[model samples]
Target: NGFKLKEGRFKLDIRKKFFTLRVVRYWNRLPREVVAAPSLEAFKARLDEALGNLV
Candidate 1:
């Protein structure tokens, strides 16, 4: 149902029979960043957007 990244400090929840996934990041820090209602393709798009934003 879910997977986590130790270094990046992010968690992903992929549910069955659902068109959306959830992403939770920065759990160890205050005011954790959580994102939901993201489709698989939209998730990838967000990743690309983040990379571009960092550039």
Candidate 2:
């Protein structure tokens, strides 16, 4: 599975903060295991477990 998403070119700095762009940026930073989770529920569980360690 592809682990990265292509970011769209932006003409203005503000465009980089658009929802789609922001989401893409965040998504790209996720671990490969999290991004490659086999199901939505599994993804959420894995992501939650991963993020919990930061607190």
Candidate 3:
């Protein structure tokens, strides 16, 4: 059977303008691994790319 997954919000690192995650241990269950982004807009763009790469 496949995994039952959930995605939480991206928590911001205010000093660096980058985003972090709520869940860290479930990376292996995910098809796309997250990359830290410099801004919200950049994060969205990269998120779209990650989703697009998913089969």
Candidate 4:
């Protein structure tokens, strides 16, 4: 699943160790799932896994 996250319609808290993504204007594009990591390493790992799947 590919979804583009934009601040114009959502809230994002991006930090070195933690990130938070929230849907503010969930009108047409309601989220089907939510995922977050407590650490940057974990986040990168998750991102890598997702990218690997795509290729």
Candidate 5:
């Protein structure tokens, strides 16, 4: 299961402000290893580690 979401085409700039569009932008930025975690606990750990590296 991939974490990527197909972003929909938007005819207007305002469409980019939609919650789904905003979330997709953020989601697509995550590291593949974080997104590909095999379980919820693993995902949380990976996410925490990844975010910690940003600091």
Candidate 6:
């Protein structure tokens, strides 16, 4: 998984268990980002990693 700034938004490529999910969330509206995961730990880890890369 990787992230980069493109155009004017943060582009994220997150993968787990062989599946990849692409997400585009604006930096200004990060608080509104919704991420669904199978477990609380997974959700937190993924979200942290994704947001970490953006920063």
Candidate 3 overall Cα lDDT vs. reference?
A: 0.50
The best candidate in terms of lDDT = 5
Q: lDDT by residue for model 4 over 1-55, one digit each (tens)?
A: 2354654432543532233334433322432232355577875776667656669
- Candidate lDDT values, in order: 0.39, 0.86, 0.50, 0.45, 0.88, 0.46
Tens-digit lDDT string for candidate 6 (1-55): 1333243323443332222222333432334332445678876887787778778
Encode model 2's per-residue lDDT on 1-55: one tens digit a residue.
2688899997899988788888887788788888999999999998998788668
TM-score result, candidate 1: 0.35
Please, what are the lDDT tens digits per residue for candidate 5 over residues 1-55? Answer: 2668999997899998989888887688899999998899999999999889999
Q: Write down the TM-score for model 6.
A: 0.37
The segments of candidate 3 whose C-alpha lies over 4 angstroms from its true place after superposition are 1-34
RMSD of each: 11.3, 1.9, 11.2, 10.0, 2.3, 12.2
Best by TM-score: 2
C-alpha lDDT (0 to 100) for residue 20 of candidate 5: 89
Ranking, lDDT, top scorer first:
5, 2, 3, 6, 4, 1
Where in model 5 is the C-alpha error above 4 Å? 11-15
Which prediction has more favorable TM-score, 3 or 5? 5
Tell me the TM-score of each prediction against the true structure. 0.35, 0.75, 0.38, 0.39, 0.69, 0.37
**Clash-forming residue pairs, model 5:** none
Model 3 scores worst on lDDT over the 10 consecutive residues at 15-24
lDDT accuracy of residue 48 in candidate 5: 97
Collision count of model 3: 0
The collision pairs in model 1 are: none
How badly does each model clash, as a count of residue pairs?
0, 0, 0, 0, 0, 0
Compose the digit string of candidate 3's lDDT tens values, residues 1-55.
Answer: 0333444444555523323333433443344324445688875787677767785
